[model samples]
Target: MRMDWTALPEAVTKEVANRIDGSRVLPATAGDHAEIAATVAGARGKVFVKAARTELGVRSLRYELRVSEAVSGSHSPAVEWHFEAAGWLVVAFEHCEGPHADLSPGSTDLGLLAATLQDLGGTPAPDARLFVPSERFGFAHPAMDGDRLVHTDLTAANLIVTTQGLRIVDWAMATEAAPWVELAALVAWLIGAGHTPEQAEQWLAQHSAWHEVDPAVLTFFALRNAEKWALKSRQGSAGWMHDLADWTGQWAAYRRRPAN
Candidate 1:
């Protein structure tokens, strides 16, 4: 149900055009998502627009908008304007320009990402009923319960390498959980980026948030992550999904091994 920006209903386009003070809408090439996205060029400047036309899109975009509004700053985009009419919800953001993070083992972008994660961890989790990672993983451990605002999806694609620094976007899957949760997820991503499981943990461990987590809890989390990804990988999805699942599975196995 993805609609091009130019093809969007007249009402939705009109609203966006008014907000950006633009006379025309130039739709960006679609990504793998269920929403209409584009950049509108106006007299003032250009602003990015993402709109949801379906019920699922509405719910997802609403959550994304909420998180964007909650954590307003350079790290996250601010919602310039938002409106819902004719069964469509739209929000405009200050366009962040840059390529996705280069997560290769020795890439400098990793340093920037470290800084970004540190800042995000310090940001208080919004006072909303966000999904808890512990519940999603069915972990009975108490360590998983805390009020840290975690991006959850820490893949390279989610981190944009902008001039200021690395910025985490795609808040649609954000959740409230332990401060160390994101670090744990990054461990898997790092492995996917060609770092050994041990090296990944070593790199993320430099962050203070990772220090706050206990060893036993981390072990449990690794086990659960391996289980989740392993199941998904078995479903026969090709490419990154399967590759990431393998990477996470490797990290879990590494955790299970006896320390020298």
Candidate 2:
């Protein structure tokens, strides 16, 4: 859905120009979501902007802005401003410069990422209405209840490795769930980064949150996530979604293996 500045409506472009002082657009990375993703250079400085015209996209971006504002700046980029213009919902965030985190095995980025997650675990969910794991996933579980804010999308692309530290982006999928949910989400990312499911869990076990939850619950989460991703992939989602389905399936399989 990524689009260049020229793709925006004339009215939208004019509004953006006013907000940023001047408009020099550098289209952001091509992500599956966000119709207008770009870094705008202004007389003030650069600000990353995400704008959407579709109803779903607009709602998602607005919700993301709300959830993102609630998160501490240490964990996410600061929201500079947001407004609606000519049917587009646009939000600007402090421009963070860095490549995405390297999740491959033995990468130093793991430590930075782990620290960010640890800090996030301590961050309380915003008072604003947000989805809890059960509601978000459409399955009830007592273990899914918690007050901590959870960013379910832990893909490397969303984890910007800035000099300040690892700053997580894309809060559209943010949830208020148990501290363990984020760790659970990380398992699939590790698998995609070339770690076997067992190896991923082994690494995750070093964290306290991993042990706070029942192993049975983790297995259930893995199975449910795998089913969700697989269904999405089958339903004509992006081709890369198949990789998510595969990674989550591997984790579920590992968890379901009989104890020796």
Candidate 3:
């Protein structure tokens, strides 16, 4: 269901407008159960807003706000600020220009993205309070360290390359997870887009440390992500899901097989 911004609690709308220097507000895009992507006029910047009417949505929105706040000042370029007023949570961020007409695993954009993740390794974990429990790891590996703040959801739509550098937008699903988790997710995403395993491995080799992690561990995370999209595909959830399940099952079986 799409939210009518005009009907948003006046205070929430006012706060968002005021933060953007009173820019003319225009709707940008809507996703899943949230309405987002608003352009702020004067500075020509954009702010993304999410409002939820259901109990689950409200809980998730709160979690997103917390994650945004936790990673705010870290070197990672994520959502800048979050404000809650009148039953809405608004996050303001510097807008990024183009995803470019062409974006792929081998694009220079991916190179820049890899470089950004490499730099994030140096960012200090802000506070322990923001640490989400291990079981809350989502797509991240449960055994991986949660010290560094992670974007968790680094899908193509969330990234944009601007004159400055790569800017990651959309923090609704961001969380603190293993540093390699982001890298693993990126690799998995490339595979799902049809890049061959060899190609994915080559791309991942660019980040040597991340590549050195147990291949099975990395593949497990990758396969889990693949199963998620498979479930959502229109072709029929069972087939795609089964394909991933079978691939993993076969991998497990082969790992346990006796030496030939």
Candidate 4:
């Protein structure tokens, strides 16, 4: 959830200070999760820093750090440094400068994002405790099974549109799933970004890997995703959960529509 950057504990601040020379902490207004999210600039350059003290938050951050280490290629920003300070686990990554990807129709970012996803699909799944589609969506099909790692969270916010191409951030929700699941998960975002369901699928068809997913699996994913987001929005409606609930519901309904 979007949160104001409060002053860090003196000891925590001091510890972070000791690590980066002439560091300046700038508050971050984006991102849904993270206890402390900010940009730290110093002698070297800017690094996006995310720190967490809560047990769940710390564990998630550590897992993401591990995943980041295993992931290679220019698609993801490199990890800068990470350390524990004042009981909080702080991790930093190369601060990539760019706006969140534009998924709307007619945006050039669509191609860049597609290329990035294709590149990321080639990264082998690291030896880690990873979530399967059923573990996350409560329903899984044979088509969802694969050895390749996929970034389950395809929200535009996680995709930075840099000059070189799109750079994906936040590996906290990365999962082990079929390559197609990566693009399948992006359908809702396309709808949310103003594409009709048919249009979204047409765009997805441009990728050869997308042709491999079973149509039944897409329908199942849409149903479960709609249900999942709806439940979460009811519990806590902030931080784009409600938006996702709406978009997923729309996609599901569109998929269920009768043949014209």
Best-matching candidate per lDDT? 2
For all candidates in order, the CA lDDT equals 0.78, 0.85, 0.58, 0.82
How does residue 137 of candidate 2 score in lDDT? 73
The sequence of per-residue lDDT tens digits that candidate 2 reaches over residues 1-260 is: 66677888888878778887889989876466788899998787899999998988888898889887877758788999988878889899988899998998899999998788788888889877788787677665789889999988888989898888888888888899899988998899899999999888888887899999988888888888898888988997576889998998998888888860
Structure candidate 2, residue pairs in collision: none
Per-model TM-score on C-alpha atoms = 0.88, 0.95, 0.71, 0.93
Better of 3 and 4 by lDDT: 4
Please give the lDDT score at residue 24 for candidate 3.
72
Candidate 1 has what TM-score?
Answer: 0.88
Note the clash tally of each candidate. 0, 0, 1, 1
Candidate 3 per-residue lDDT over residues 214-238, each given as its tens digit: 7667656655655555554535555
State the lDDT of candidate 1 residue by residue for 124-183, as single tens digits.
788776768765555546777778788877888777888887777777777787778878
Model 2, position 53: C-alpha lDDT score: 89
Tell me the spans in candidate 4 whose CA falls farther than 4 Å from its real position: 1-4
Q: Write the per-residue lDDT of candidate 4 for residues 171-199, one digit (tens) a residue.
A: 88888988888888888889989998889
Ranking by lDDT: 2, 4, 1, 3
In model 4, the Cα lDDT at residue 213 comes to 73
Task: Quote the lDDT for 131 in model 3.
Answer: 41
Candidate rank order under TM-score: 2, 4, 1, 3
